[model samples]
Target: MSKPNGQEANHSRQPLLEGRSVSKYFGGLAAVHEVDFAVYPGEIVGLVGPNGSGKTTLFDCLSRVQDIDNGQVLFKGVDITRKKPHQVAHLGLARTFQVIRVYRKMTVLENMLISRQWRGETLWKMLKPSHKDTEQRARELIDFLTINHLTNEKAGNLSGGQRRLLEIGMSLMPNPDLILLDEATSGVNPTLIETIKDRIRALNKDQGISFLMIEHNIQFISDMCSRVYVLNYGQKLAEGTPDEIKANEEVIEAYFGT
Candidate 1:
């Protein structure tokens, strides 16, 4: 597959998301220590590191699920270091957890329909039946993700990859400017991994949505991201184009050489 746009072009655009000295602490230890990164508009950036390298902790800080002990996060040029999770979501940011968070008892369509429930609509409206327009939008997204046939299937019954796709669709319901995908390809069969990849490319290329995904699948990151960032021991280990990152000796020793 062809690579994403040149780094020169991305450098000219304001980052859709930026982290300045981002940090998180647990007692005496820092889970994420003063890491800085950026994802420009319409770009697919990869975040990769060994397990327990503070990647998800950084995601938690940026997504505002966890309070940072220090530093700031900005999205679309607006400071969001103190914003609530719902507030960030309202700002066109959405995310998937490393552990999938789909509503197991709900059908695929139901999950998608209610994904936007946290958008500050009236309590009564949320409690009532989903509107026709909302349902139609859900159907269209289902088709886009190529899971239309599973619309009525229970989320619990779906395979690992399908559940991941549902979670992604749930994220897309709000028409986000960026999505933080944590471990999107983990435990997924190879076939569905490709499917997930195609959907992400379609979302980025056709709709102009940006992505910052955490992945252990190096090949997936190599194929999808124009730029990649590496974290190790709660700090920025490396940042560059995929080829440059692959050639970094420090990154290889800390991450890939294991």
Candidate 2:
């Protein structure tokens, strides 16, 4: 997979995340074959494929939600293939699930604060007065996502798009270096989708947060991603820019059966 648009010039630099011959299997069935993927620092990369094409499976493997049957995953040059999920999160990697996971019963502010709590923090620490710094940071992120008004509302009361936005904000609570977003725009309205896209771009531009996104919205991917990888039946089918991918014969055939 050759990166275009001067990305090839940065090949000498280390990628923020890399998958080398990564594979995952469920029983005898291979959900993900040996796939090589890379996300450079501060880059917005897209993973697109038809349903059951292993896009989410690759995300699972990368995030340590599912262990790979073969090969390895590297984050910031450290082998994280064998690390636990929480350990992975602690090591500057965070991911959002395909299904939004939120504390429905809790207020949005509590949800955000809880996300910032480390694994070993004691109950007493949580019961202690809310750290002004943490609360302020959470509020700042909520405002950045334009959901500050919902700060005191129950998370379950939020709309689907709002929940998605909240989830993204929660992922940022940990200040991760790379975020794997699974369908960030799925089921979101066009207006909110554009907002999500703009926020993603702003995060990348201002904070240097790199992203690897699994998206079915071709136009969304085309607009935001500098590079993309296509999967088919759990294998790498192609890798290129959005225009090149749209024009690729295999991609068209795989998606449209043309």
Candidate 3:
């Protein structure tokens, strides 16, 4: 097994997610411009950049949260650039936001169970009770996240890192093949940051979940991502292994500024 980001053993020939000349525009500004990248099955990839460099914008395009002005996004070998967010989610792609999206008033267990509420076959099938298996899955994920002790606790009361874990748990309820994690470490304490890293490694190794993470935590990316993509001013700046990325002069000028 490759030590950095569990690289070689996990990657297969075909990419699980691909962006072909993908672009998104905000009026006159090109927020993301014809960016191309890939995340292979069971692999962890990182997207990093200085602030306003289009990392999260690219995530939105891939997740179908924002309409791409150009190019295509394929997930699990299916075209998803035109799909709605929930439709993409149904097709085994899930994402957490830069801002944590947990329901603060709801308990940890309730948040988990409710995550499936959006997947109701019919939009009108509202306010229905959670199925038995759904509850079981929620409990299991809570335990896996080491938040079982907080299951009954309101999400509002938990710390920043705990909410991040809960959001991850919610994403797992979909049984997704790939998850686009948007800054899983921001605002988290050092201790909890380590916990998040360990859990992500376990999920990638044990459960076979592929990840495309957008992060500013440089060390976190080095430790978890096999390949890193750097974006600057909404275009891809570089793509390479962690060590190679560290040595890239262009990245140093545009991102590291060292």
| Per-model TM values vs. the true structure | 0.94, 0.93, 0.94
List the global CA lDDT of all models.
Answer: 0.89, 0.87, 0.88
Question: lDDT by residue for model 2 over 90-109, one digit each (tens)?
Answer: 88899888999999999999
After superposition, the stretches of candidate 3 with alpha carbons farther than 4 Å from their true spots are 1-3, 7-12, 120-130, 256-258
The Cα error of candidate 2 at residue 250, in Å, is 0.5
Model number with the top lDDT: 1
Q: Rank the candidates by lDDT, best first.
A: 1, 3, 2
Error of 2 at 94 (Å): 0.8
Clashes of each: 0, 0, 0
Cand. 1 Cα-lDDT: 0.89
Task: Give candidate 3's error at residue 80 in angstroms.
Answer: 0.5
